[model samples]
Target: MEKQIAIIGGGIVGATAAYYLSTLPGGQQVKVTLFDDGLGQATTAAAGIISPWLSKRRNQQWYQLAKAGADLYPQLIHDAQLGTDVYQQTGTIVTREIPTDLELLFDLAQERRQTAVTMGSVTTLTAAEVQAKIPLLANAQPGVFISGGARVDGAALVAGLLAQATAKNLTIRRERVHLTAQGQVVTSLGARQFDRVIVAAGAWAKELLAPLGITADVRPQKGQLIELAVKDYPIQENMPVLMPEGERDFVPFGHGKLIVGATHEDDGKFNLQVDPTVTADLFASAQRLMPSLTTANITGTRVGTRAYTSDFAPFFGPVPDHEAILVASGLGSSGLTTGPQVGRLLAGSALYGGTPDWSEYEKPLATYLKPSAE
Candidate 1:
């Protein structure tokens, strides 16, 4: 019989998993089913901004995954028939008023052998230098670090992945999943047996796993962002600029708008309402970082909840007692950059014994699974 795999969650992680599993060596004989309650509203809220360099400091594992995902975009776009304009390779700029601790950042990049360089002494940049790089960043502080990175339209990326999965004949079930013993899963739409099950439900993973005696300490970290529509703004390119204050990140989408985000709030609730205070704080930071955006009109604003683990690294690999189940959650803020690689890793683990230990890409499987009380 063909091996059956049930993937819970249709976000980037689940969709990418389905896509990769469908293309594996023996994947033609393998059957993949994806389950999700919501389409792209929950954790895949089209708010992801993909900048490889800025996300490098998170960890070596994440950096590798992000870099690998960056490499996968070209083929993914081609396979999905997604428009090339969906991905903007405008690069990213990391700016700081004074040089912050580049030691850890540099060490990480060096360990990964990443393409990073310290431009001269960490002195302030001239207005002309800033304009030459970011064109949008005017009246900025002295020091800045520029690196090669790309910005992906996350909404379009997810849509394209979904379309590709459908074209590949992967079954998608639009329903909630209820886990049974021994890693069996039942969905509202129907029930199917699988050789393995993967829980990529993001923030909701813990809820589904709780009934199965597995506990996931994943929490929802709320990130609120504002979109501004400024047609004539000089920052026409799609690059991310880090603010000097609190290390805020501002990404300009190529389509006459900029996304200023992100507040990490651990309220333990999934609140999607964009807070005015958060928006004001983000705008203030953006104006300080990119002065030209001060005149940009606010087009829209939104709040997204991301999944985070206790250790803040992702939870991957198989459940301890129930070997039939695997998890790929707790991506936090690097969902877009790391989602594809994570999916591939999980799929490989399912097919093979487990994910290969590629330097920092240690699968933290122990955190999600526990032995049943005797």
Candidate 2:
């Protein structure tokens, strides 16, 4: 009999795990089922920036995880057969409003090259030169460019993965899951037994794991973004993503769509309403980065409640006591970069047990994520 694997989420983590597990050695004898509530999830609202070098986070583990996330995009796109609609390598521009900031970014560029990170051509660009390639950029601020930066349409990618997984014998159930008993998960299709159940439900994970007494404490760090119709400005197509050091960032969505985001609102609610103040501030910020954005119209707004972890690292491994209930949550804002990597790790843990034991990390992660036990 084949091993039955039930994944309770259709977000990036669950979707990627379903796809990867089905392709592993001896995977032909496995049956995988993915459950989703059908509401579009957080990955859909991601800023989709794949530039790790631009981050100011100096923690060794954080840097390595983020870099790994960026480094895996190209191969992930190819392996998943995701087209350019879902993944595009338009590169990124990290700008600096001051000389010190510019020097720091330039120095990081050198560090990336020394560490064998192929950031295409890490070169400093004058405001005028940068504006020529991206006329919207503020011509007063200098920036360094990474020729290898890219963006992913998080929604498109997840949809594509789910579709592909469905085509490859993976079952998709649109319903909330219930853990009625040990070694079992109940969905809309009724109760069923599974060899292993993975809860990669993002922000909703801890509640789902309550039956097993695991505190996931996945905080929904809300990221609100404004998508503008920028084709009205006749800007260069495929202009690299731009972010002034320590300011709000913007990514150019293909077909004249540019995205500016994201406010880290940890208010702990499903507030999808685009706050007028936040939205206004994002627009003003974008306008400062790209002068032409002043003429752009607000085509739409997106709100993705990122699963912010205490340490900013996702929880990926089996629950300590209940080994069958694995988790891959709290991915925060880098789901696009870390999706494939998370999938691989969880798949290994679920299948052959070769993945790193995250026992020590799980308690710390849960303490940060879970509510008080009063």
Candidate 3:
């Protein structure tokens, strides 16, 4: 009998898991089904920035997972055959307003580089030098550049991975679904049993787990951003991603296209509405660092919901009492950075029976997922 596996989400984690599980050796022994409603998924709305070595966060576990995820991109790109338009190693430039602060970040990058060889050459650049590298940057602040930093198109990545998996006979249902404690997936059509279920539903994991009497630590955070098109700036195509001191980071793509803004609204819960005032403010804030954006035409806007935990840490593993179900959430803005690796680990667990302990990469599953008091 074929092992039945159902993945309740089609975002980065779920899609990547589908790709791995369906394409792995002896995959014919297992059947994979992915459910995706195409709603406010965070991956499609994200500006995929892959630099994690310079993070100031003190979470050592998160740093480990993020570094590992960054390291997996080469394998992912190679296996998935992603085009240059889908993934690029143009590198990253991190700017700081205070010269001393920039110096501190540079020192930190150097200290971290000993362990993170993938960070490539870490160097400090004068404001003029930074401007030369990224012509749109107008800020006078000094910056640090990391050669290994890369950017990806999140939506493109998921599509490519899913396409690969689908070619391998992975079943995809375009419907919202829920799970039962008995290891069944309930779609609008009906309920079906599965040997295993993986929940990578982003913020909606809370609702999906509710029916199973589990309390998920996930909460919804609304993120909004805008894409801009600049005229006569072909060089903007391969310009390195510019992350200034604040929320407005710039991710450049080919054909003079750039992504900016991405306000992290912690209280905005699941709302996907694009507030013109908020977008206007984002453009204003972006103009502070790259005044050239003021003349660039706004091509489009994207609003998506991100999952976050109170402690702002990500967790993934089997449900406490319901080991048949696996869950991953609380990725927040770093989902693009850590998602693929998490998916790979989850797929490995499903393909080979018995969970591979990942306690070092995250807290215990019980910490974020627990039995409901009711």
Which candidate comes out best when scored by lDDT?
A: 3
lDDT of model 2 at position 141? 65
lDDT of 1 by residue, 4-52 (tens): 8888988778877887787767777777888887732434554554556
TM-score of each: 0.83, 0.90, 0.97
Residue-level lDDT of model 3, residues 218-278, one tens digit each, is 8999999988876546676678888887658888888877788688998789889998888
State the weakest 10-residue window (summed lDDT) of model 2. 360-369
Give the Cα RMSD of candidate 2: 2.8
Alpha-carbon runs more than 4 Å astray in model 1: 39-43, 46-67, 70-75, 78-81, 99-125, 143-147, 232-235, 238-247, 290-296, 351-359, 372-374
Candidates in order have lDDT scores of: 0.67, 0.74, 0.87
lDDT of 2 at 47: 59
Backbone clash numbers for all candidates listed: 3, 3, 0
Q: Which runs of model 3 end up more than 4 angstroms from their true locations?
A: 232-234
